[model samples]
Structures are given as C-alpha cells and as structure tokens.
Target: MIKYIDSYDFFACQLDNQRCRLLALPWEDVLVAHILPRLPLMQLFDLQRVSKRFRALIRLFFTKRTTFELVGHHVPKVAFFSLVKDNNVLRKLLLESCSSWLTDNDLLPVVSRNPRLQTLDLSGCNGLTRHALVAVSLTCVHLRHLAVARCDFVDGPSLRSLADHCGELRSLDLSGCCRLTDATICYLAKKCVRLTFLSLAVNENITDESVEDVAKNCRGLEHLDLTCCLRVRDVSIRTVAEYCPKLQSLKVKHCHHVTESSLEPLRKRKVLIDVHPPPRRDRLSLAVDCGPYVNIQPLSARLLPSGLNADPLRAHMNGPAKVSDPWKNHPSFPPVMPHLQSPSHLLTLHPSCLVLALRCSSSPSLWSL
Candidate 1:
C-alpha cells in the first residue's frame, strides 16, 4: 500500500509540470489567430484593459478594421472623446444624433486627429457650428460623403469651404438647412464635380439657376432631392433630364411649378420621380369655380327657361351683354361676361361654363336647350 502511494505522487508531479509548460507557451503566437477574430467588439475593447500586450493587440485589430461608430446618448462623452483622440487609423466615423453632448471642441479634435477620414456623418448634430464643418473640410481632404442635415448653423460659408477643400466629395445632404440659397448651391456645383447624391429638400431659396448649374457641372449625379424647393420650376426638371443621364431617383414633392408635362423626359429615361399634386386650393380653382359657393342655390327653382338656353351662343355673337339681360339672371351664367371674340375671353369663363359653351356649339340637344 505504501509503494502504490509513492507511484501516484510521482505521476501527479509530472501532470503539474505539463500544465505549467502549456501556460508558459506564447499566447501571441498561438491565441491571436484563433481567438481575436471570434471575439465581439465589446470583448475586444475590454481586452485593452488587461495588459500592455493586450492593449497593443486590440489597437492593431481596430486599426486594421478602420471604421468606428459611437452614439453620443449611449456612450459616455469622455470615453468617446478619448477613443477619437487615441485612434489615428479610423477611415470612417459616424456620430449620428449626437447633439446631446457633442460640441465644436470635441469635433475639432476628432477631425484634427483623423486626417485620413473618408466619410463623416454628423447628422442631427445641431450643436455643431460652421467652424466644425470648415475644420473637417480643411483636415479631411479625402472626405467623400458628409451629412449635416438639420444642422441649422451650417450656412453659405461653411458649404463654400467644403466645396473649395473637399473636391472628391461624392454625396452631401443639406436637407432642412433653410439658410442655403442659389449662391451656395452654385458654389458647390462649380467645385464638387464628382458629387453623385445631393439633397437640398426644404430649402425655399433654390431656383432653376442652381439646378442648371448642377446639370452643367455634375455629370455623374445619380440621385437628387429638391422637395419643398418652392422656387424650382419645370425648367429645372427639364434641365436635369437633358443633362443628367445617370439620374436614377428624383424627389420634387411640393414643387408647385413642376407639371407632369415637364417630367415626361425623365420618365422616358426610366428615372424614378416623386411628385405630389398641387394643393387643394389650386386644384379646386383650376377645375371649378368654388368661390361662388355661397351664392349657389339648389337647381330645382333656379333653372332658366328652355327658350333662354336654346340660344346660348346668341349672347356670345353679340358683344358684351348688359348685367340686366335675361341670361344674366340665370344661375348658369357668370356674374360678368367679357366680349367672346378673342381667346382671352375663354380665360374669363369658369371651366365648367367653358365646357358647356363648347358642347352647345357642337350639339345643343345634349343640354335639352
């Protein structure tokens, strides 16, 4: 029994020596390839707190990844700033809806550090100013996509700075930037020739001239939004159709002057166009005269005699009729009639009455005249 115990102790010592050799093996050579790729981003970030070796490995992993995103509301501001200040290899950074704590100073350090940034999205960052945008444009010369929508502080000078510096810019969103005008758009059109997607929705100051400038310069444009650009007319639509052959999608909602006729060219090219009808007031005014609704009585007792309707064209044959004429008392007749000799006379008639006049000339029996 004593000889058996000695043999068992010697076996246990050999097992302990094997365990020590396994633990002493180099983890960088064995574990990095097998473990790092499978780890979650949070886990990788936590690894940075383990030791200097771990921190170096995680930093190398992030540098190779080259993209980072942080939300201002969820992540602590100090942590985010520290990450931006530390990471030098990030190529894209998205700080969306970050108005809660993001400021110009925080943004300045980020752009200043990451001069290689190619895409930066600061959408809804209302706390940002013109200085931040100018700083980014100056620092990140390779920036291709930028979105500053709803940043009310962005104005003409900021856009001009971007146009001058970031010539490789491909996509830009200035939606809800109410201060933008034709001058700013013209500056962008002339400078950013590589722009492919642009949104200027809700900017009331843009006109056909700015659109024409874009058409003349930005040949590679694929998508455009001019929603609520009240000054934009059909001429701008025609200009885009004629020039931008690659245009795939266009939004012109609330652009009152853009009629269906003007959009035919774009449709023929298979471009997707989003257009909404004119307001109720304009539609009603064009189709019928609803203005005299208060004066309209029920037709039961208001109809003119058959004899009076029999010679409806007789009133037009003579020049302008007096207000005291028999037909003048008829509800169907307008309150006033101009001489019906020129084409302009048709303009004075209600649309319904105009159709009635035309029908009377072709077949008076249709109305039982």
Candidate 2:
C-alpha cells in the first residue's frame, strides 16, 4: 500500500519515491481484500502474485463502487451516488495496490471506471502515464480536487483530461508538475470555473499569463499559490483582483518581478487577503499595521526600500492604535467582516472621533492607520 504523503498538500513532488515502501502487513495478503471495485488499495497489493485467478479477480475490482466494495464493505443503497458536499476539500481515491504492483497497463480499468472521482490520489503511482488522467476525466463527473503532485511520469495529457471533464473542480495541486506550459494552464482556466485553491509552485514554465486565465474562469477562487514560479509579474496580480472577486489569499515568493503595486488592489478591494511577497512592502508586512481587517504581516519585508524609515512607520502604525481602542485591545484572531476597506473600516475598530492622517507626514502610507 502507498503511505506517508500529505501537507494539506505539498507544492512539489509531494510523495517521495524512495524506492522503498514500508507497509505494516504481509504483501501477498493485501491484494485479496474481500471487496473488489472499492477494495482499499492497501489490501489489494497483497494478492496479485498469488495466482492467475487472483489476478483475474483484481481486474474486476475496477468497476462501480457497489461492485468494488461487494468483495469487502457493503455500501448502503441510499449512499450509492452521493456527491461531495465540500467544494474546497480534497478527495482520496485509491487505485493501485502498491508501488510494486504498478505496471504500465495495470491501472487502465480502474482509471476507465473512476469517472468524476473528486480526488484521485495515485501519488506513488509512478508507472501511470498521462493517459490515466484522460480516462478519469471522461468518467468522473464530480471530478474536483485533483492531486497528481509526484507521479512524475504523467505529464500534460493528465492535465488535458482534468480540464476537459472536471469543470467544477475547486482545488488542483500541480506542485511538481514541471513540464506544464501556458497552453495547458490556459486550458485548465477555461474549463475549471469553481477553482478556489490552486497550487502551481514549481512549474517553472508558468508565467503571469497563467494568472490571467485563473482570474477569468474561476471567479470564486479564494487561494492561489505560485511560490516558485519565476515568471509572474504585476499583470498577473492585477488580473487576479479583477477576475476572482472572492479571492482571499495569494502566495508569490521567489517571483522576482512582483512589487508593492502588485497588491494595490488590496486598498480598493472589499475582501481581506493573505499575501506572501518579496519580503519588502509585501501585504503580509502591511498586515501588522492593518490588523483590524484580519491582516497578518507579510512573511518577508525585512528591509524597506532605501528612502523609507522605521520611525515614520512606527509613528504611522501608532496613529490607528491611538484612535482605535478595539483593535488595540482585541485578541490575535477575529471574525471576518465584509465591507471592510481598510484597517480603520472594521466595525470592531470604528473611530470615536475624526482624526485624518497627514498626507505629507512621516508615515504617510501607514500613519493614517
């Protein structure tokens, strides 16, 4: 059985293929799990070598959930076609029995039958090519939340399949999918309209144009991560604000072209956002001075640009605290408030008196806070 892979999800080669597997049970016994189509992959890996009869039985395990589970657990008739309720959460569908059981053609039947499976985690399934993705997309109608993080052998065709079928897909992680190109990303954007969380950290070939596609197709997307993508720029961030009105978080570390203006939308946006930028002038850093709106300081922002000084910043930061007692005394985490435009707009921190910040003052940017 496959094991030890998770992060909520990692952005790259998520499941390590050390060429060594550590399952607690005897190998031969697992393949014969009482169930067929829905047998826990952990059990099926045990019986493949027993005989030709077991091999034939294993082939049948790739059918409907009812048929698969018949050999193992009984499914309630009422739950036959239940759909996933959480559009944001990831799904887990076991296909292969184990790494050793993997072969070029072994996973075909399972792939052909698992249409609309939300999360098909064939993580250590190194033997599968991009073709399996095509098969799954064609069958899995509820297909959303896909994670092909480490199956390096599967390439663009896998993405092509997901794009073709899983239009309602919400979360997709392509962290170690290094071979992807803008054409593939554009294809995904056009089809996946409900995508909320997407991770494409190490896909070095991607650029700001990919962000354009995400914004246009997935308007409700809440979290977007481009951690190690080297080509992203301000146009990408701008596109995000314009297209994904529900966007709540963005991560763009190691992207050299990004700057403070990349986040100018935060000042105008009605929603709160979590952003990871280029250390300096990142929204995360700005969050410290704008906490009433649920802002957290940027993870980086070690040094302000040449002309900015901390004293003016300190004074600007202190201005809001002086007038907004609620924010000054509030707990570290607070409930989200809509219509929030700035640190001072939060209902929890409404000002008792008018105290306009000086336009030319030392902390003109933050002093008004």
Q: Give the TM-score of each candidate.
A: 0.63, 0.49
How badly does each model clash, as a count of residue pairs? 0, 27
Clashes of 1: 0
lDDT of 1 by residue, 141-215 (tens): 999999888888889999999999999999999899999889999999999999999999998889999999998
lDDT of 2 by residue, 148-236 (tens): 66667656677877788778788887777888888888888888877898988877889988888878888888888888788888888
Output the number of the lDDT-best candidate.
Answer: 1
Alpha-carbon shift of residue 74 in model 2 (angstroms): 25
Question: Given candidate 2, what's the lDDT at residue 136?
Answer: 68
Which pairs of residues collide in candidate 1? none
Model 1, position 140: C-alpha lDDT score = 96
- By summed lDDT, the worst window of 10 consecutive residues in model 1 runs over 360-369
The TM-score measured for candidate 1 stands at 0.63
